[model samples]
Target: MSLFDDYHPLKGKMFQILKPDGTLHPNMKPLLSDQEIFNLYQKMVFIRLADQKALMLQRQGRMGTYAPIWGQEACQVGSGSVLQKGDWVFPAFRELGASLMMGVPLKTVYLYWMGNEEGSRAPNGINMMPVSIPVGTHPLHAVGTAWAAKLKGDKIVTISYFGDGATSKGDFHEAMNLAGVFKVPTIFFCQNNQFAISVPRKIQTASETIAQKAVAYGVDGIQVDGNDLFAVYAVTKEAVAKARSGGGATLIEGVTYRFGPHTTADDPTKYRREEDIEPWKALDPMVRLRFFLKGRGLWSDEVEKQVTEEAQQEIDQVVKEAEAVPTPSVEDIFKYVYAEMTPQLKEQMEYLKGTL
Candidate 1:
């Protein structure tokens, strides 16, 4: 039997640390300390509140269409927290939690969603790419960067975040193949939220699991309970260490779920039944983490109240700062496309300027 037979990446058996009831498995305890776990829990709660606040902002016309990271907090926060300062992160649109953990300001995130281009700019020295709206394309950028880092003898790992639907794209397959062959230090983090917009995972591909696809490229892959913060953190830490040690790339399939619509513009009720969401709700990452902390006497009603109030204050300030920025001019849209505008673009810019 293959060595991986017992693990069965194709079986949909997720590697979990915390059970649905917020209890840890006897043999699967995380390496994190009480303080570390408490800090992680605080970050998760903050991200969840920020996500909800973004939704409310959208409804109130304070923001453009927003992508909700309502249910994938653990996957993003755990993986993001494992990275060092030198590592690079390439995020898909829904990675607000990860970006926030990576030092992307809440105000910047809000500005991006509120249709400001400056929000896309990462602070100097922070190794994050602008959010990629195109599915699966940024993995190539990550792989290329990883390859360059490897060539330069830099011990840096690059992580690319995408949804399960991205696995079906040719760009994803090509990036995986190239990374595997070149032994590039890249981590392909796929949050398998069970749906690609309206299409369920069943229709996205024939592969039993997204992680299993890595086998074809001769790269290591694993499926973890995306809702289990400990599991996500453990697997991601292992992947980053291996990458730093020249073990090539890893594909991590985080089996997660999106509790809300794909975006503010897309309605889940049109395609999914309400019953399908209940089971996932019971396995909420924040709730399970909260339970673990409460059981350990590390959490209390007062702590909850304090954290909630602090998070609200922070998010309120972010919104205020984001809204205070002056609106972009019509000409601003034409500015970032090129260093020097092509004749055709210049003509178009001139025409638009005259119209304005």
Candidate 2:
């Protein structure tokens, strides 16, 4: 018998419920009700608008550099929709949709990009860490938090979100290994958007799939079509259930695409061809979901108009609030970096203050 005789046949296949043409797989219908699906659609539209508004703000010099989540809304919203109130989320910088779903206000997200420390603060009783700009480091933090929760007999599970590039980091491997060994209730959610900035996914790893990395760590892994909201929701819901039931850890690789430049500072056209992106445009998650809803009579132009108008108004208010907040002092940056200021830091702060 071959060494792979017992291997899972579906390991490399992308789990998909909604097909790209807006039809559902006959046997893989989503468990969500019509109203629930509508609600999810509304949330997706809201975040897409917010994301576009942020990009515009950055261009207008109203905000600092931003990472746009244009094409990956379903990946974030679908997975994030499954979280319970008490669960924790650790997000890399691109997870604005996930943060928003977890009760981080629009104004706070805007405030964060505008360089305010207050934007990082999660509301009381909300379990979300500030955005981790250092790539793969937060997975370790998520694992640690989950391990602590396990030790304390708390039922909460933690989910860590990172990009395709993060999988190459030592911290990612260490966290995965530790989480598996300890059997902590953690979900390692990787949104494989095909590029780590200008670097393509194929060059990022020699492995056939990012999800298969879980095999070495002895954790369960699944690959989902991140553009299919139904598939993303189903996989994440199953993972969350398993974690709560002491099933150790799981890794989910969401195969999606980023439709914009990596960030405000980067130009994607130099690295990616227009023809390469044209195919993914046909697979846009929002368009697919809208078609599904329309076929079921749950969506229409009027509904789309209403949702768009409402979201734009809400975003307008959030932009106003964010801009009204005063710019953070230079000391604000140094203050949040330490629990109690070290002597060296104190001296540096004094010198900086003197210079000001």
- Top-lDDT candidate index: 1
- Cα error, candidate 2, residue 132 (Å): 0.4
**Candidate 2 deviant stretches above 4 angstroms:** 1-10, 339-343, 350-356
The lDDT, on a scale of 0 to 1, for candidate 1 is: 0.91
lDDT minimum window of 10 residues, candidate 2: 1-10
Which candidate achieves the best TM-score against the true structure?
Answer: 1
Ten residues in a row with the worst lDDT in model 1?
Answer: 1-10
- Tens-digit lDDT track of model 1 for 64-140: 99999999999999999999998999999999998998898988888899998999999998998998999999999
The positional error of residue 297 in candidate 2, measured at the CA in angstroms, is: 0.9
lDDT per residue (tens digit) for residues 195-261 in model 2: 9999999999998999899889988888889999998998889888888989888889999999988
